[model samples]
Target: MNAIGKTAIGLVFALLLSPARAADINAGKSRAAACMGCHGSAGVSNSGLFPSLAGQSRTYLEAQLKHFRSGERVNATMNAMAKDLKDEEIQNLAAYYAGLPGKSAGGDAKLAAAGKEKAAMCMGCHGNELRGNGQFPKLAGQHPDYIARQLTDFKSGARKAGPMNPLAQSLSEDDIKALAEYAGSLH
Candidate 1:
């Protein structure tokens, strides 16, 4: 090969071997300031209405954010908020939130007990502790109200979360309440 062709091949090899860019937590924290209104400080939602983002899987968070950005996951506020975010910003935000500690909402003992019985089915996807696995979002420390709301949405076809729709459809109102209580009570 000529000198120019050799140099081009060498550059391509170098580019292919280069390490992927890492997420910047500091930048993420700065970007997340706008999200704190409802997502809470440090990604922990103070209210039961919003789902806590702290300690969630980065992959799951990124996917959800992208879905919202693309209008695939329909949420009025999220779609609007995520619309302007760049790919790097989403990665950084997911990394920042995933590094924080998780917290759970306490619930009635009886309700939690009932929910625990049904939670076994959830273990397959969410893991034994309900901390989530792969693309699934963490449920261990989520708020009961948020959990119930999402489940209800899935059941009613208001939310379209793949397997969750059919699974939620199988749950009764009481089952949702019980499961939310149980899932929320987890640490």
Candidate 2:
């Protein structure tokens, strides 16, 4: 290609490939104050019922927030919280939470070991580390409450997806508990 065409293509490629720049941290911090009660001071999450938002991908976080707002991923608390947030606000929040470090919730050693066997079915998509990839949210070190809820949702058909719904349905309640316990133990 000619220099002019190449240059134009390069510019377009750069724009497309560049990481999304986060909004003002201070604004996000201020907005995040309300989130601290459940999500922890830096999005780590204090409650078992809530998933830790720390270190989650901004894209994933924003997408989930949008899902909650749209009722695609229904949760009363999240829906109410996310409904009023503007796109920018959601982006800012996502960026802020993504910047935090993740922590391990620690699980029963026995359960974690057994859970590993139970988790074999999950590894194909969730990764061997349970860190997940692309659209799949990381399951490693996730809250048991959150994992259990997702498993329940999958089993009950509240969270419908081709893979997860069937997988969840196949699992017994004990199996779900074992999987959650196992996932929460991984760093």
Each candidate: what lDDT?
0.92, 0.83
Where does candidate 1 stray beyond 4 Å?
Answer: 1-16
Q: Where is model 2 more than 4 Å wrong at Cα?
A: 1-21
Identify the candidate with maximal lDDT. Answer: 1
Q: What is the per-residue lDDT of model 1 for residues 32-139, given as tens digits with 9 covering 90 to 100?
A: 999999988978787788899999999999999999999999889999999999999999999999999988778878999999999999999998889988799899
**Which pairs of residues have clashing backbones in candidate 2?**
39-45
Candidate 2 per-residue C-alpha lDDT over 1-187 given as tens digits, one digit per residue, 9 for 90 to 100: 8999999999999999999765766777789998888888877775678888887777788889999999888888889999989998988888887777788878777877888998878988877778766567778888877888889999999888779998899999888888888988885
Model 2: what TM-score? 0.83
